[model samples]
Target chain A: MHNPSQSGASLEISDLSKAYGSFKALDAVSLTARQGEFLSLLGPSGSGKTTTLNMIAGFTSPTSGEIRVDGREISTLPPYRRDIGIVFQHYALFPHLTAAQNIAFPLQRRGMPRRDVAVRVAEALEMVKLDGYGDRYPRQLSGGQQQRVAFARAVVFKPKLLLMDEPLGALDKKLREDLQGEIRRIHRSLGITFVFVTHDQEEALALSDRIAVFNHGRIEQIGTSRELYETPATEFVARFIGEANIFSGTLVRGDAGLALDTPVGLLPVETRLPAGRQASLVVRPERLEIGKAPHAGSDPHVPATVRDVVYLGSNRRIEIVFDDGRTGIIRGSGRGTDVGAGERIDIRWSIADGYVVPFSSSQTGDGHGS
Target chain B: MLNDTRLRWLILFVPVAVLGVFFWYGVADSLWKSFASPEIGLQNYAAFLQSPAEMAVLRRTFLVSIGVTAVCLAFGYPYAYLMTVTTARLRTLLMVVVLIPFWTSMMVRTYAWVALLQNNGPLDRVFKSLGIGGLALIGTPGAIMIGITQILMPFMIMSLYANMVRIDRRLLDAADSLGASPAVAFVKVFVPMTVPGVVAGCTLVFVLSLGFYLAPVLLGSPQHAMLSQLIVQQVSQLLDFGRAGAMAGVLLALALSVVALGAVLARPAIERGYGENT
Candidate 1:
C-alpha cells in the first residue's frame, strides 16, 4: 500500500484543444483522473490521442483550454517545469549514458546529493527488475531490457503523472506481454497517475482504469473497459472497441420494443432512436447465437446462410449472409459442431444484447475489427 | 560493389602508388634529413632542439591552435544543434550561412577578415565606439585567431551537425519530462550524447590549426609567427632545409600525437553512442 497522493497528484483537462492551421488536432477534449488511476487515451492514428498526451506533457502548447494538475494551471508551463515523466514510443534512452547513469540523470539535475542519487538509481533499477544491468549501454541491451530501463528512468523521480505515448508499440508480442505485466506491477507499487496513449484497444482494455476513445479530434466516450465494451454510446465507439456486426436501417416502433427495419430484418433493440430517423444497432460477434429458429419466448431471430467459417482456436467465426441480402458475423465456441461454408443456419440475438446507436449514413454496414 | 578481390586490390593500388610517389616519399626524405642532417649525426637536430626561440614559437603555435579549437567548439556546438532542431526550410537557410565560408576561397575570407579587423574598418569602428579602438587587432595573435576560427568553424559545424542530427531528439524530451530544466537537460543529456561529434570536430580543428600558415602569415605579425611560418623562415631566409625539415617533423608528430590522444580518450564514448544513433 503506497499512497499515490503523496507522490502522485490528480489531473483535470478542461476544454483542451490544439489546432494546426485550419485543421483541428484536438477539439475541446476534457478528462480527469483522481489521484492514482491508470487512464488510457485510446484511438486510431491521427485521432488526437497522441496530441492530447503531448499537450498534457507540455511538449505541444494548446491553442485553447487548460490542463491543471491538482488545480495548478500548467498549460503555460514548459515541459521541464510540469514535473511529469514521459516514456516515448521508441525508448529514447541517452545512448551515451550507461543504464544506472540514465536513471540517475533526473536526480542529478534536481541537484540531489551524489550519494542519494546513486542509491535512488539502484532502487529504480531493481524496481524494473534489472538489478545487475546498471553498467550496460542502451544498445548493448535487448529491446525489452531497454524498455525496462526507460520505465525506470521515467519513474525514478516519482513524477506526478507518468505519460507514456505507445511505449509498448514497438515490441514484438511476447516482449509486449512481458512488459505489460511489468508495467502493471510498477503501477500497483508506485501508485502514480499513469496517462497512457495507445491505439491498441486490447492493451488499453487490459491496463486502463478508464478509457477515453477518441475519434476525429473528439472523445466519443469515456468509461471503464467493461462499460465501453459492453455499452458503447456512439456508433464509432461500438465499432472501434470490439468486434461488432453493425446494421443500418430506419427506426420503427414495434410491439415488443424499439426496432430497426433493415436488410437484416427488424432488429429489436433496447435503445430507442428518434422517430423514422436512420438508426444503427450493434450486436457484438460473441453475443449472437447460432442454431435453429428461436422459440416464441426467445429473442428476435433471422434466417441466414453460412458464407464462410473461419476456424479460430477457441471459437469459429461464422460469416452469415442474411435472407435480406446483408451480412453478419458470429463468433462462438464450435467444439464437436459440424459447421461449414455455404451451410444454411439460423442466427438470433437477445433484444437486450442489441445496442441502438445514432447512425450517420457516412459509415454504413461494414465489419469492424479492432 | 567491389566484391571482386582483384578489382579491390587494383583500386587500392592506385591511391597507394600516388601516396608513395608524392606523400610518403617526401616524408621519408624529411625523416632522413631530420636525423642525417648537415653533420650527418644529430648536429642540426640538436641546434633545433636547444634553441629557446624555436621552442617559444612551438609553444605559441600550440596555444593558438588550442584557442582556435575552443572558440570553434563554443560557436559550432550551438549552431549545429540549432540546425538539427529547426524546420527544413530554415535548416537549408542556416546550412547556406554555415557553408558560406567553406565555399568561398580561404584566402578571400582571410582577406575579408583583415579588412574588417584593420583600423577604422567595420569591426574596428564598432570596437572604437566601445572605446577599445586603441587596441591593435590587425597584425596580432588575436586577429590570427579570429581568421583561423572563421576558416575552420565550418569543419567543426559540419562534423557536429552530421552527428547531432542523428541524435534521437526524444531523449531530450525524456530528460525534460524527467524534471530537468531545458538548460540542465542540454548539459546532462544532450551535451554528453553529442560527445562523439565534439571529439571528432575538435580533433579536426586542432590538427588543422597546428599546420595553418596562410591565415597566420596574412593576419599576424612577425612576433606572432607560428611553427609553419618559422619553418618557412628557416628554409627561405636562413636557407636551412635540414633544420626546417626537423621542425616540420616535430610539428607533424605533435599533430598526430594530439589526434591519437583524443581518439584514445573518445573511443569508448564514440563506440557506444554511434552504435545506437546509426
Candidate 2:
C-alpha cells in the first residue's frame, strides 16, 4: 500500500489484478514510480511485465485495481486523455509522414500553431541527434534512425509520463546498448517519469535507477540494481540477475555466523540461521577462487576435477566437478594459470561471499546447484 | 536448351493461338460486318457519336458506375474496420455473410432486389404502412442504382477486409498514446493505411458496374438505358452492327483507361500504406 507523494506527477498503482478467463495475467501487482525517476519493469517472457505496462498505458484495463497519476485516479481514463508517451518495440512511425511530421502529430492534435509545432519538432529531432533527418520519410532512414524518430514523436509534446515496451528489442546488440545509454541520458535531461519494460536483465541493470523484477505475474523483488544483485530476497531473483551456484545443505552453529554441511565439504556462510535448519547457500561464480593450494587455510577448500573450460574474452569460465560428484562454475580473469579437463584443483570462497536461500522443489529441479 | 525453348514456346503460343482465333477473330469479324453494307466507312461510329440519345445513355452509365463505386467505398470501409477489430469467431462469421452474397448468382440477387422494391413487395408495404406514399421506386434509376450497389458491395468489402487485416494494431496504439483519440486514429492512421484497399475495391466495383447488363435492363426504364443496354439495343433491335461495335470499343477503352488512371493515382498511397521501413 505505497502511496506516491503528490508533489509531481508520480504514478501509484495498487492491488492491480488482471485475468483472462482462467489465466491470470497479473496477480495483485503493485508498484509506484516517483516523478522524474527511470523505473524499469524487468522480467522474462510470460512474466506479466508487458501486461503491467499495458495496464499503466491504459490500452488494457485492470480487472480490478487502482492506477493513480499525480494523485488523480486515472484507472478508467482512456489512453488519449491520459496524455502519456509510448515508444513501441517496432517503432510505429507513420509511413506517409516525414520525421518532422511524425513528431508534429501529437502537437497538431492539441491545435498548436504550425510554426510552434515546427519549432518543437525540430527540437525533438535534435534531442535524438536526428536533426537533419526531419525531412526524410521513415522509409528512407535506417532502422536505428527510424527508432530515434519514434522516440522523438512520442516525447515531442512533453507528456507527463513515458512508457517504453522493449523499445530496443528490435535493434542489433551494439545499437541496443547505444540506445540504452541514450535513453538514460534523455531521461536525465527531460526529468520525466519513465516506465520501461524489458526482458533483458543487463539492460534493466544498466539503465534503471530502480528495477522491479517480475516472475509468475508478481513482483519477486524491487530495489536498486546493487541491492537486488547483492542481496536478492529469493532464489529466483538471485538466479535471474546473474549466474549463481547454489548448494543444498543443513545449517550448524559456527563462531562467525553459520556453517553449511554440504556433500562436498563443510563451508562457512555469513547469514543467520536456525541451528538445525535446512538451507541453500548461493554464491556468485566470480567470487570463487581456483588455485593449486588453499592459501594457508584462508577458507575451507574442496578438491575438484576440471570438466570443461570456455574462453569468454575478458574472463575464462571453468566448470569443475567435486569429489562427491557435484558440479559448479568458477569465473576468473584470463591469466597464465591454465587448467585443462580432468585436472585436479582446489576451489575456495569466503563465507561472506555467499548468502542463505530457502530451498524449493522447483529450485532443485533447475539443476543449478554447485 | 532446345527442349526448354520448345516447352516455353508451347506454353506461350497455346493461349495466344486460342485467343487469336476465338476472341480476336470474332471482334474483327464484327467490325467488318458493321461496315460491310448500308453506308459503310464511318457512318455507324458517326451516328453513335452524333446522336444525343446515345450520348445521354453513355453519360448515365458513367454516372451510375461512379455513384455505385462511391457508395461501396463509403459503406465498405467502416465494415472492414469493424471486421478487423472484432473477435476471430465473429470476424469469420461476418466474412462468411459478406461472401455468401457472392456464392449466389448475381442475377438471383438482382431479382431479389426487384421483388423487394416492387409496389406490393415487403419493403414498399412497410413504407406504405409507415404512411410514406408516392414513392414510385420500381423501374426507376434509383432502383437500378440500389440493385447495382447491393450486388457490388461484397467485392468491395472482401478486398478492403484483406488489406485492413494486415495493418499492425500497434500503430493504432501508438497513435492513441500520442494523444490521438480513437476517431482521430481512424481518420489519420487507419484510413490512410487502407488507401490501397479503397482504390482496389473502387476499381473493382466501378469496372463491374460499367459492364452490368441484367440488373439495369430488368430494374431500369426505357429512358434509363445504360451503355451496355444501348449496345444491345443497337445490335439486336435496330440491327446496327457498326454502331454497336463502336459503342463496345468505346466502353472497353473507357473501362481500361479508368483502371490505368486508378492504378497511377493509387501508387503513392499503396507504397506509403505498406512500406515496412516506416
* DockQ of every candidate: 0.62, 0.65
- The ten-residue window of minimal lDDT in model 2 chain A covers A361-370
Best by DockQ: 2
Clashing pairs in model 1, backbone N/Cα/C closer than 3 A? none
TM-score of each: 0.90, 0.90
lDDT (tens digit, per residue) of candidate 2 on A127-224 = 99997988888878988999999999988888778889999988899998898889988887777889999888888889999999888788988999
Please state the CAPRI-style docking class of candidate 2.
Answer: medium
- Stretches off by above 4 angstroms in model 2 are A1-8, A254-257, A293-300, A322-327, A334-337, A363-370, B1-45, B131-134, B273-278
Which candidate should be chosen as best, given lDDT against the real structure? Answer: 1
Cα lDDT tens digits for candidate 2, B1-278: 56998999989999999999999998787767656636557777778789998899889999999999999989988898899999999999988888888799988988898898888888888888899976857788788889999889999998898888988888899889888899999899888888777878888899999989988988888888889898888889989777788888778778889889778867876555472221
Tens-digit lDDT track for model 1 on B174-276? 8888877888888887788677788889889999999999988999989878999988998899888889889988889998998887788677776785622
